[model samples]
Target: MTGENVNDTTGDMLRVEDLSVEFRTANGVTRVVDSIDFAVPRGGALGIVGESGSGKSMTSLAIMGLLPKGGTATGSIRFDGKDLLSERESAMRRIRGDRIAMIFQDPLSSLNPYYTVGVQIAEAYRSHRSGVSARAAKKVAVEAMDRVHIHDAARRADHYPHQFSGGMRQRIMIAMALSMEPDLIIADEPTTALDVTVQAQILALLAEIRRDTGAGLILITHDLAVVSEVADRIVVMRGGHLVEKGSVEDVFSDPQHEYTRRLLDAVPRIDDEIGELRTTAIPVVAEEEKR
Candidate 1:
């Protein structure tokens, strides 16, 4: 919403410096995201990996200006050259779906039950692009669905969210995000609750989309394996603190933090001779626990 062109590809697409999120309650102030810093280069993918309550999702919400009641975010969230933390809600509304789109973990909860998937996607597009005709917007929706590899997208667009399987529903979410052609996409736990095969497919689709569209991606998840497959860099967080940050290969091969090492250890492995695949899981650390 600043007069600056968000589409400028000169520098990092996003940069967060000393970002902190706090909540004020009857009890007192509690900090959930504490002085964390990271960046996503233009057209690059960054994975924020941490356990539940690590503030990964909260950080994303803070950037989107969707923080819940009593929550406050301080410090810098720069998108292109604009400081989002200082922007008014009105300005953020204009920038959110247009320059920055977010995909949540639960597609069913995000999508409306009564509306057709096409209608939902078209509405999202129209919300950001004023004066766009309904027919044109619908066409964009179909195109987006197809872009995400939804077969027979034109026909599938007419179906309700309930009609689609879990994987298909997630694709609809991605299509909605893609319809706007946002500059940055913040996906929070996008692969959660999906099967291994579908998870791999979705990750591949995300990688393909980034490669094709050159849109910067921030994937927030607990699975190191998922990030290893899709993200170029990884940010490891624990108890609201950044424990480690480096390339995916570096972090996977030689994790600097003990917590990170434990997380990598928790990732399930496959034994070729045994022909068995193990389940993948992340260790849950309590809020008060010190790593």
Candidate 2:
């Protein structure tokens, strides 16, 4: 999958145009992310929100050039003034962890159980930086762990992924991403596996990392509240289509689509009437999108 060159910097860190992802199966080609377009300016945050099977993760994977087998992505993904989709696999390999980093939802699954946390982080750092010795890389790994507020990072770095709690493992993943000091960070449902308190902590930590490093952030999730908490702008997707997008205040206060309204209405509120009836009906707009 490749795209034509479009040299439009204009202060944007990442620019995507008519991006689409499809998977070819035994039956036929199924589009998972359809003609979506958005931008993340340098040091800015963009949130992609939607329900399950909405192609939020697929969009991120397409940008990373990590699509699964039989999956193909078309259209333009411009990153830092270069067309990512046009780059060769080797070029993408250099850019992936060095210029762009990703934080997946499940750290346990993402991290290798056979390796120590320190070694994994060190290898990730050393992979992009040539001529870095193992000792130096280990030091960098410990420092990265410390940066994420991992307690006793130097000691914990020697432990395997299973030795850490779910939240701790997630922090380790964040530390690994930060070790590269990438210009862009794409977090896909980063808080999905944690408790509410830990989720808030992780979000705050991510916000702090962005603020401190001035890296562009793309957060993908289904929770509108989570996006509202951290994202400066939001794009709402449904059934692989981009339904609406705007500033946090704009979209939340004045949703222009029925699907967006239904999503907002479905959120449980603390001050609701006792035993108040809640509607479980899917909106007509959403139903049409499914079809």
Candidate 3:
């Protein structure tokens, strides 16, 4: 597939071209993410789907400049016409939680146990905006919690993260991300630790937030069904290489690559006729822009 795009800037929020990530080890240099290309358009959502160790998370980390100590990324990662790969660490720090926020897989590990939830959220807000008093920051934190539909947000703000349930903790993480009013959000397995019902709720919340803020979204996950309704486009990866990329409808209905067809077959369906699983590739018509 081609990796070209239009010159217009209507929805070109994040563009990743020929991106590759490598790690140096005692054995030798190992490449975790091969040369890959994709883009998340303005106000649009893109999902990266594959099994474990497929480099989906690594791709997200590369874009955020949060790769492991030994990992290094090559190629271009442009956000709003600025190449993040070329920016200094200090400059990247300014952009990380301010212009581009992230929602991690687990909130418990990400949140601090020593501080109150409200204080943590307030600190994240005040760090980006200077000359903000504690009272105002706390007010912002409470409002953010309320926006996420947290019950008694003012009271819960004073409580520790351990006091809340897993679902509520995730909402708190979302509140922290919303406090920054970022232009793009990279959510890595946001609903992994939650139950099925909670997973649906979190996904719905993410969709609503995207609708309200018009922020570009990059959802990194291993489940194909998890991102089916949330993402506008889908990119299938295998062994660090992009096996198929297309609109969500196109990829789900008619996968072009053999690897992609295999993934679809692995998903359990309720309406399936009790028979053997098919592994044949379906016809896929390539669109003009294969972002």
Candidate 4:
């Protein structure tokens, strides 16, 4: 879909208002994502969190114009200035992978196993801009991989997705997302499959990319800790509806909703109660003093 001009909306980089999605069941109409209102400013990061079926993924899909067939989406997804629902698929395709892009959770599914990593990245680049030669596109791909700290990017460029480790494959996904240099990047649980350490690395890399490029980010996930580090704002959803929305500190420290409060409490903290638990163990190790 043709992107609406940003000049039309005040302070709205991406505004999703009253977006309702429904699925037709033999039983009746089942609404998956209720009418929800949220916005992301230029260079802003909005984190969405909830349990499964909370409609977080569906919301992102609606925004990306990638919702599945047979699902009816209603409401306004204003990117910059245009209403996305009004645009046709071909129009949206032009914007997708160019002005706007997504990084999915599963790198293996997102990438082509048969093609070289470089080939896929280059293809993505070439699709948007005409006259960008294969060599030039590959150069962009390599540069993007290098930017994400992929070592020997030129050498790894020809490797298939299966050849890379899980973390490396994730880095490749980020590189592809970065290649287009889109105005917005919808990353749906980008670190879910990675180990804790690698998760941090990917999050750090995304934060760095966001800082350096000034691109607005929509991070969709269920982990509060992940969003706590990278998201400026957080929106909590429950049972297909929004329960809470606020800055990271506001939602985590002083949550208004009971669901949000419980989510915050569930997160394991390094200090406070955890520290007390450790202290209890520490006194046992000094039994010699008591003797």
Candidate 5:
């Protein structure tokens, strides 16, 4: 389970080097992701920011071994010193939800409406952990839900996805990811389509979770505002190329690339401080209310 460090003595949770993704069609080959390099330090947060079709999601999908048909990835994707690109599908399956978890953009589509939220969460947990009783898995599911601040989680577990608000359903997605206690979490536009207040709540919850669990985070989003709140490092992508990479502070203070500067300008509140959006607090529930 141990992995060698990437270009440094300090070990990294995940390291991507010269990764390129391409799709072959009747017309020709299209390279959506050029050779790009980045790393997530253990327990650190890395943000991949870009506009739509900038290959942010494709890079994550490549890391997860979930690339869509007709797409192929080349170069190294190292997770904890292991070369994920070389790993077999079976090995990747074992590592996917168990060691590395992903939070998708749309929780509704990721969840099943026919199943109770608890059932879905428990099933996911059981799939990764063999020989666990359903009752044990269900308990884990409830705990996970509670960990994500889903109020009345034990009762709410029985509710279907539709019964929950958009923010709450996103929390459910996070709960499912937390249930596994993975080493790294890749969240792709997790706050998309959420209201401003709800987005802040979700971001706070994610920051709290990372602090509590010491899990490395990969947050992919187009919003510079969102990443400024949570990420320690920033990677800017455009047309599959890595235009900029640096500490969040440096990137925000003095962007080197024209594209990066444009992205910052596109922020709705460009006048406001960049990293100040993290002040939102996660709501706390009393223990007595759990019953």
Candidate 6:
């Protein structure tokens, strides 16, 4: 986590202001994102939530400077006071994988089955800092695995992507992201492919990492239940536009908009729903007795 490494996970991180991305399609021009503004403080977590096609992923990819071809991005992404949108490709190379890192949802697609997991994680750390030996890099990979709560770090390090389960592969992806210790981590639906319990574990790992390194975190997910446990604040997007933004409690307990209300209503609460059923059943029993 040396300051020079860009993986220091320190300092005020990313600020995205008035960000927009548009694509020229055969039909016409489509504005996928429009003037979205959000700032991730030095040590905080922000969750971006919306249904599919809300442009949450594109916003993060824009921040990472990884937008696909034919998409024109406007506005500014300022990270550590450096203008990301205007930065040269060479300068962006330094920041893209080092200062700011990302973890995608599908590890199967991200990690190469041919390469060993340890090699991939080490390459990420080695890419930023020079003169690092393979042994040291491998140790960092193992330690990252341990940090993420992966059992048998050394054994798991040697395993290929196909060897590990879905949850394990996702952990391996997370290990790679944290191995470099980036200052800001943008996780795009990191747990989307995992089961409920595994998703909880991954979120907990992310919470632990943010606490340990004090890095700004932008967790992109449509699952409000997942974000509720970890995010300090939440941003809601709809139809490529900003819909609602507020603290978790504010949005959950006192949603100010109809869309937010519907989103919350869509979440299935086991205890509350069961209690309602039981309470209604008691009235049914009483009515039967009266009959």
Winner by TM-score:
1
> Residue 217 of candidate 3: its Cα lDDT?
81
Alpha-carbon RMSD, each predicted model: 4.9, 5.9, 7.4, 11.1, 10.7, 10.5
Runs in model 2 with CA error above 4 Å?
Answer: 1-10, 269-291
Candidate 2 residue pairs in backbone clash: none
Across residues 1-291, which tens digit of lDDT does each residue of candidate 5 receive?
222221132787788999999887666777889889998888889999987777899999999999999989999999988999999999999999998999988999999999999999999999999999999999999999999999999999999999999999999999999999998899999987687789899999998888888888899997888999999899998778888999999999999998788777767653353422223211321112111
Where in model 6 is the C-alpha error above 4 Å? 1-12, 269-291
Candidate 2, run of 10 with poorest lDDT: 1-10
**Maximum-lDDT candidate:** 5
lDDT of 3 by residue, 1-291 (tens): 111221224767899999998887766677778889998887778999877677888899999899999989999999989999999999899999999999988999989999999999999999999999999999999999998889999999999999999999999999999999888889998887787678789889888788777777888876677778699899998777888999899998999988887777766651252211233323332212122
For model 4, how many clashes? 4
Candidate 6 similarity to native, TM-score: 0.87
lDDT of candidates 1 onward, in order? 0.86, 0.85, 0.84, 0.83, 0.87, 0.80
47-94: candidate 6 lDDT, tens digit per residue: 998776778999998988888888778998998898899988888888
TM-score of each prediction: 0.90, 0.89, 0.89, 0.89, 0.89, 0.87
lDDT of 5: 0.87
| Worst 10-residue lDDT window, candidate 1 | 270-279
Q: Supply candidate 4's per-residue lDDT for 104.
A: 88
Instruction: Point out where model 5 deviates above 4 Å.
Output: 1-9, 269-291
Collision count of model 2: 0
For residue 76, give model 4's deviation from the true position in Å: 0.6
Instruction: Name the lDDT of candidate 2.
Output: 0.85
Over all chains combined, what TM-score does candidate 3 have? 0.89
